[model samples]
Target: MRAGIIGLALAGAAVPVTVAAPQATTVPVPPAKAPFTFQEVMVPMRDGAKLQTVILRPTGKTGPLPILLQRTPYGVPQSAPSQVPDSYKALMKDGYIFVYQSMRGRFKSDGSFTFSTAVHPDDPKAVDEATDAYDTIDWLVKNVADNNGKVGMWGVSYPGFAAAVALADPHPALKAVSPQAAWVDYWMNDDLHRYGAMRLSYATDWLYMLQHDKAQDSTFEYDQYDTYDWFLRQTPVAKIDQDYFKGSIPMFTAMLDHSNDDAFWKKQDWLGALKKTTVPTLNVAGFWDQEDPWGSWQIYYKQEQNDPDHLNQIVAGPWNHGGWHGRGDTMGRIPIGTDSGIQFQQQIEAPFFAYWLHGKGKRPDFEARMFESGSFVWKSYKHWPPRGAVEKSLYLHVDGTVSFDRPDAGEACRSYISDPDNPVPFRPRPISPTYPIPDWRLWEFGDQRFVGGRPDVLSYKSAPLEHDLTVTGELAATLMASTSGTDSDFVVKLIDVYPDNYEQLREKPELGDYGRSLNGYQLPVAMEVRRGRFLESAEVPHALTPNKVIAWNVPLRSHDHVFKKGHRIMVQVQSSWFPVIDRNPQKFVPNIYRARPEDFVTARQRVCAGSKITLPVMAE
Candidate 1:
């Protein structure tokens, strides 16, 4: 599936107040008997910026309650809900005041909106997200009626980013923070770009709507429904500003001018600023999150670098961006076997906040908790990569098969001619806008059969496993490859190929269509694209020696999946992922965004016999 970068308005949950092992805990937050009242507040920041905030307080007056703050760039809900959303029902019984606020530049808030900004450690006067969160917490503890001074913050996607900002020099009252599917570094692996390939579809459209009218919502309108055609018509990134934006939007110009990971992008590397963690942090993630998926794990690892308190824990599940809000039970065309969404909300999230804010429970025992797909099992561990995990390489063979054994010396290399005019589609044709449609986000799970046999694509699938093959951590694709042109892009996808005669499970609750027969289903476990030029240096550019094989190391992020018996492992290599990523001209150009139409050229690509994908095999 295509990874998206949008941060949506989602629910919040914390670990339940229980000492029972995670899997053994499942009690939901019993319905609240105390009445609650919602109040609007324009909280003044340290810089005097008044943020529009809504405070939901329990009227039980059962002594003062802790405050749970969720700062978001998306508008705050205008009215309080009659019932807690099912996604957050588990947190309802804890009885803490819920504070929701819109960040600066969003509705009713007083500043300009920024997609992402670097943490300014050098400047004391810098007014970034960290400072905003600190100010919000300070104000809430000071003015709110809540007698308990403790506070906890959590949010999904963009708001998840807001939750992360609270960890840096957190306010004295802030105890726990969860940044789920948060956007961290834009250039590295978040939404905007992957490695150096521009996420053309997401970047342009997102910026256009966001920057068009800061005072109100302004989404870009397409002349036709098929966004694939809409983006394909806009060749070369330079034409976009002149034809549509006319250079009015600053973000658009910056995307083209700052094509490389230069200072502009470096300033957007928020994760690099995470030198330490001052508060207990719960970094949540989704294995299939289309947006901001990479940031959560990156932030978690960085915080762990100096975590003496052992306060950092991670929970990654098989869901898309913000999918844990409710849909973690099923994704794409498969049911994840358990109500993972409810489990995380009740067993993990509700308890995490309850203990920190109210001192009602103990910290979760596991350092890492994940929902292992395929097996439909939930796993908790003392350490990530589980303890005895070993690295293994699956070599590519000329016969279109992949295996752990080394390829024979006589094994020939495979070659494919890539044409810029007809680059392989990232998904099936007629792709639509990234928003306003369900299919837009589900594209990540589109049937691979559509592009598996294309001429420009090279595939290597492993034989059906006789036993379960479980991969628990990160993975990388190491391809000894070269292209006929000076520049190119390489997309490597790690796929789970199900066997024939597969059928849905009837043991658990029926997933309806999601539980449909899985015959021939090709699930994408992990995939990432690398811009060849960036291979030399993400900040510097260098063209490849024509037809000279060079190593391209592409990390497929982190995943936890079990390739069950009879299932096959597959790796699909192609140059273009369509509007998901901008096309690489294959010809060297000082600035790819400015390349002319004629600059596009055909290139012959080769994956040498030594090519292999390195996978983390967890010891049973």
Candidate 2:
């Protein structure tokens, strides 16, 4: 789940639109079939660089409407559509002047585009995303016909980053913004690296697609259908560039150049650019968002610190990276029971923009709104994580069974030999490429039974819950472990194991012989990887002394999920998670990127008795 510093090629449904409440009695709702006239224009930035923008407005309506703008690296639609897209239907029902603009250095826009989100508001000469957004909004209100003079910005993934940066230096006309699935910190937890362990397949494929061409989205043709085999063959990620790209991709070279969280990456931290909360920001996240899981949470937390106006809000659902904009009903084969995406659009997103931009319905009464998957209900909270949530530890037992109780004093550790030659696949075999294929989107919620009984993976599962157990907020794993090698990665997953009879409750849809059913499914709720070197600090990585036990804190990020009465909670720990997270050479090197094949070796890893997972359980 990552994106190039504010770089992603989003689908049309992924396009950002304003969120508003249902039509208020005072505000007349626009007809569902409002005809829109499309016009293309070059909107000039402060530095004289003109951005290519597409403006869509109701053809004959003279009623002034707030402008809903989406700034993106992805190109805009070439022509006006005969009808409003389904994605925008819920929000557009109230009437809006939709504007889509290509960011600088993309498509027909002028100037160079760097894959970074750093905005320099102090330097007059520095023109960044914030400046471009301010300039675009400045021009739209003046030039666009019948504009209410208020503009709301939104975008998914890359465009989400663009919208978030605008909060750093917002224009007066910019009334509201929703940065959905936005990327904030690159090195820590975003697209590129997870605690310094490079994401090989994603970085290789996404960067190649992004930089191969400037005017259009490019594709990287793979020789093998199964990318796992293709990536495994290219051992030591350095070969990816040495053989295929040959340094053609600039970001790819930059990533390799700065493997550590150096000044280069720190400068790209867009979260730092947000000096104050000047705009009413709505940060949206998908619980199953594979591309950007950590970003929205960080943005929401950062804004919350100094939100005096209390304009900052957040909404999370069971969608996968802009899945809310599409069919919100189901993820993979797991039915969410309702169209959560559209529900969020109509209930939260739409009303947010409506109350702020158009003065329509009432403002959202709660600070955070999350859809609980197990209970299948929308939960509103006065404070995120809720005020009464308690912290409890679920200890990992050496006996392969987990419980709230701790392990015996004699039970010190569980051992496994992690082999780089046969690294565990992040997903099932025939792993599809991140792009061009949609399988990557649902891999977060993919059944974990594929790796069942693997020797390399240590499974610790709790018995069935007596009642529904709801876990909200941040989750982390405290692993007291040691490695035979100098360095290693600890991949920890918090899974929900369904009861054997789980299939009976769900719809019995006919499968075409090959489809897998959802019986006794092992759904990973929270999972993350922590490199041993970065345990102390992300910027400075130190090699571990062989055979010495150390604590590895693996942050599983924030989640709002429920473990039903009949379901069991499980935790699986492993050393490697394959090409998704570039394989960590068990032996430490100053730069894993520069490590040779000899540096890769099978090493015995251990999880000691003291290890436990901290869950933010909702108190009764």
Q: Which ten-residue region of model 2 has the weakest summed lDDT?
A: 4-13
Residue pairs in clash, model 2: 1-290, 1-291, 2-191, 2-291, 19-349, 19-350, 20-350, 20-351, 21-350, 21-351
Q: Write the per-residue lDDT of candidate 2 for residues 370-394, one digit (tens) a residue.
A: 9987777899889986867788889
Q: Give candidate 2's total backbone clashes.
A: 10
lDDT of 1 by residue, 1-620 (tens): 12332222222335467677557676898886535687998999878899999998866558888888898766776776776668657777888888899888888889887665667767888888888898989888989984599999999987888888777667889888888888777888887888878888888777877777765656777787877777777778788888989987778888899999898998877776776677888889988888677888988888889888888999998888877786777878776767888888989999998888888888776799998888887888888767667899999999999999999987777999988888677777787777666776766765687898799999899998989888888889899888989999989988899887677456665656443567778888888999989898988999889999889999888888898899999999998888788888899999999999899999999999889999889766
Task: Report the number of clashing residue pairs per model.
Answer: 18, 10
| Candidate 1 local distance difference test against the native | 0.83
TM-scores across all candidates?
0.91, 0.92
Q: After superposition, how far is residue 42 of candidate 2 from its true place, in Å?
A: 0.8
